[model samples]
Target: MGEFEFLAKLRERLPPDGPQVKLGSGDDAAVTAPAGATATSVDAIVEGVHFRRGEAELRTVGRKALATALSDLAAMGAEAGEAYVVLGAPADLGEEDFLALLDGMLELAAETGTTIAGGDVTRAPALTLAVTVVGHAAAADAFVTRAGAQPGDLLVLTGEIGAAAAGRLLLEHPALAAELPESTARELRRRQLDPMPRLRTGLALAGSGATAMIDLSDGLAADAGHLARAGGVALQIQADSLPLAAGVAEVAAAAGRDPIELAVAGGEDYELLAALPPDRLVPASDASGEAGEAKLTPIGEVVVGEGVEIRLPRGGQLKAAGFDHFAGPERGSQPEARERRGG
Candidate 1:
């Protein structure tokens, strides 16, 4: 389909616009009003790097593009407002496939109460979608920042981690996943392809006195370091306490890798990790979060020192690392660095 035809289908799936969106899709430019504080975030997905062109389903790709961009809004504890997707697609891409892809994004957009506004559509060597989301806060202090964490604050994580990375590994080498149970494979793939943004949990934490917050886009340990450096506090993550997702351990074992290591280094979980006062330990949605279940849990504590440390249950420290785009490899202290620190 042509650009205009594709956008028309996308607009149909979008949630009905509120007062904030004076104009929806199909305009020279979209207009919006800020009822309160607003958070705007832009994210893009490139072919090969973000998704496999022909191998990955188009709908799944669409959902991921929008889901990833909205995750930033969730991190800020903001409610959905409206969105615009700039498409860099090839001319050879058929209308049906493109529409299907956009429909995927619209489904998630409706789920999050966001409408698709407007954006540019142009030709590119490969398919790419850049999404911009605008979100609004409900009340004062409803927006959380990384700098809000305190030395005494406890670090709480929302939802599961590691499954996405395992899924990625399996996708790269399906032979590895073939050894695992079918259900395990499906769950792991879902983690990578259909990650849900922590919207409700983020809002809940923002209202409940979460000191600092960041979405886990770059794996646990990497993002933990981000929160630590931003808040000027050290984080001590208990390796045993993490809420590892279902199939993560099984998949890790199949790949001859450590489950905890995967949980720490696997990126793209799209979960939220926040520093909270000791009292606000659990969000209402995850109030019944039980052991061996993927739910909110307190995995660490904020400390006065610098850098991050994973307190292994077995008694040794694993210097934490995560994906860094420019750095090639994630920067972290080797085990020897732990001894240097007098561990």
Candidate 2:
């Protein structure tokens, strides 16, 4: 389909007005009404770097393109209002593939009650998708920041980590899948290929005195270190307390790697890490929307230092590491197209 056809399809899929949006797509600009505090975030995904052609389909990439931004909104304890995307591709790309991309993104938007407002399309050398999301907070101060953690606060995590990293590894080296159980391989691959944001859990904690919060886009150790530094306090994490998903250790062993390394340093888990005051450490069964049940668990504590430290067996300590764009490629870094293609 052409640009006009694309717009028409979008209009049919997304109405011009929504429950919280006054105006939407097919206009010079879209308009929307806000509910209290508003939060806006932007995220971009590119072919080869964030995704591999043989490993992930266009639909999966498109879903993740928006999910990344939604994860940011979830980190801030905000409810999504609307989203706009700017998609670009080479002239040679087929219409079917492009439509699949839109279908994938729209499915995520619908699941989260977020409306697609408007966006621009153009030609480019490679596939590129950027999503700008607008969200609203429950209250001005209800939104949590990385800087709000206080000493003595408990560090809580939603769900397990390292599954995505393992997934990426399998994608990069598909041969390894032969050694892993089919169920294990599928789970690992799914986490890397399609991930979800922690929206409900975040919203549930907004007014429950959650002090600091961050989404685990990178690895837990690295992102947790960031949160600790932002709060100007040391986050002493208990290594044994980390919530690693089942089969991670086996996957890591089969891949000839350490489970702890991936669990702490593997990126793109999209889990939420929060710092809560002592009294706010309610049972997971009691959290709003069943948000805490079975998924929320305490893994560490904030102390009076300036960085992060992990408590290990026999009083041992380990430094946490995460992905850093400026630090260049490390473990879990995606290969450049030329490198992957053996150029």
Top of the candidates by TM-score: 2
Clashes in each model (backbone N, CA, C under 3 Å)?
1, 0
The lDDT per prediction is 0.78, 0.78
State candidate 2's TM-score.
0.92
- The 10 consecutive residues of candidate 2 with the worst lDDT sum are 334-343
How much is the lDDT of residue 288 in candidate 2? 46
**Lowest summed lDDT window (length 10), candidate 1:** 334-343
lDDT of 2: 0.78
- Candidate 1, residues 1-343: lDDT per residue as tens digits? 7767777776666666767888766678887877768888998888866777665689888888999998888788888778888889987788877877878888888777877887778889988999999889866467898888888889888877888888887787788876788988888887787778877667777777788889887778888989999988899999999888888887788878788887787788988888888877754334424222236788899999898999888898876567655442234432211211000
TM-score of every candidate: 0.90, 0.92
> Residue 323's C-alpha lDDT in candidate 1?
65
Q: Give the TM-score of candidate 1.
A: 0.90
Stretches of candidate 2 off by over 4 Å are: 283-285, 292-294, 329-343
